[model samples]
Target: MSTARDYGLDEDYEWPRPQEGGWIADDLDELPHLPRRTELIDGSLVFASPQTRFHARTVGLLERALVEQAPDTREVYRNFTVTLNERNRPEPDVVVARAGADTGPKLTRLLPGDVVLAAEVVSEDSVDRDRETKPRKYAAAGIRHFWRVEENDGLPVVYVYELDPATKAYGPVGVFHNRLKLTVPFPIDIDLTAVDRRR
Candidate 1:
C-alpha cells in the first residue's frame, strides 16, 4: 500500500514567511508577499494576529484532548491556515485531515475535501470573525463539522455546529460545557473537559 509520502507535495517549497508576529493590514492587490496566516475579509488582506495566553492555553488544551479522544486513524492540526478557495483564508484553530495528508507541508492550505472538521478558539478580536462571519463561509463550503470555542468571557464554552443544507446556514448541533464530552457528527467525539479545565 502507498503511504502518505506518496502524495507528492514538494516539501522543498518555502512555506511560512516572517512577519512581526501580529496581524497587519493590506489591500487585496498586495497579498502575494504575505506570510502564511493572512486572510481576506470583504476583499482586503487582514493578518490573523498571535494568540493570547488564554487563546494559547485553550488551543493547546483542545489539541491535547483531540489527540486523546480522536481515533489514531486520522490527523489533527492546530492554529493552521486553511483557505476557503482563493479569496478567503481564515486560519482555523484546529482542523482534522484524512490520514493520508500527514506527509505534506504544515503551512499549506487544506483543500475542502481533505478537511473533516474545522474549529476556532475565540479571542476578543476573533468574536466577529468566528461566530458571526465564519459560519456563513464554512457552511457554504459544505464542511461536515464546525466548532467555536468561546473563551472571550474567561470561561471556555463550546458551541458545536452541523451545516444544514436546507437553511444554508450552520445550525447548532449543541451548546455544551465541561460536564460532558462534546460529540461531533464526524467520525470522532472530543472531550470538552480538557479545555474547560482552565477554570
Candidate 2:
C-alpha cells in the first residue's frame, strides 16, 4: 500500500487531497502562508471564500460592540483560532474570552473553558458549517454562548443561543434583526443595521 509520505504528500500544501479519514488541526498549521482563512471540520479542511466588504464590516461592528460591553476581565478578539479538539480548530470571526495577565510574546490557543462566547458572521461559502456543524461542536465543548450573524435582504440579523447543559445542545434565546438587546454575557445594545449602512 502507498503511504502518504510515499506520495510526496507533506503538510506544506495549502489544501492537500483529503485522506481516507481526513485532516486534523496539526496538518492545517503546517501549510505555508495561506492566501485566505481556512478551518478544519470533522477532520476535513474547509477554505473560506474571499469575504465581501459587507461581511468584513459586519465582523468589525460586532467586535466593537462586544468589546464595548465586555468587562475588564473579559477580552474580545477578532479572527483568532480556537482549538475545539484534535480535529477542529475554527477561527471564529469574533471570540470573547477570559483575559489573562500574560501579555508576553508567546503564542496561545483558546480552549473551551477559556471561551465565554464564540460568534460567526455567515459567509456565502460557510452557510452550513456556521449554522449547523459549528454550533454542534461549540455546544459539545461546553462553550456558554454562541451567536450567528447573517445578512438578510441587505440587513444584518443576529441569532443568539445559550447552551443547555442537560442536552449538550444550544437553545435559541432570540433573533434580532434591527437591534440586539441582550443581558447574558452583559447588558448591551447594538444597531444591527449599521453593518449595511457603512457599506
> Which candidate ranks first by TM-score, i.e. highest?
2
Model 1: ten consecutive residues of lowest lDDT: 22-31
Query: After superposition, which runs of candidate 1 have C-alpha atoms over 4 Å from their true positions?
Result: 1-36, 102-107, 186-199
Please give the lDDT score for candidate 2: 0.81
Candidate 2 clashing pairs?
none
TM-score per candidate: 0.71, 0.84
Instruction: Assess candidate 1 and give its lDDT.
Output: 0.64
lDDT of 1 at 126: 65
Clash totals in order: 0, 0
Badly placed stretches (over 4 Å) of model 2 are 1-20, 101-108, 197-199
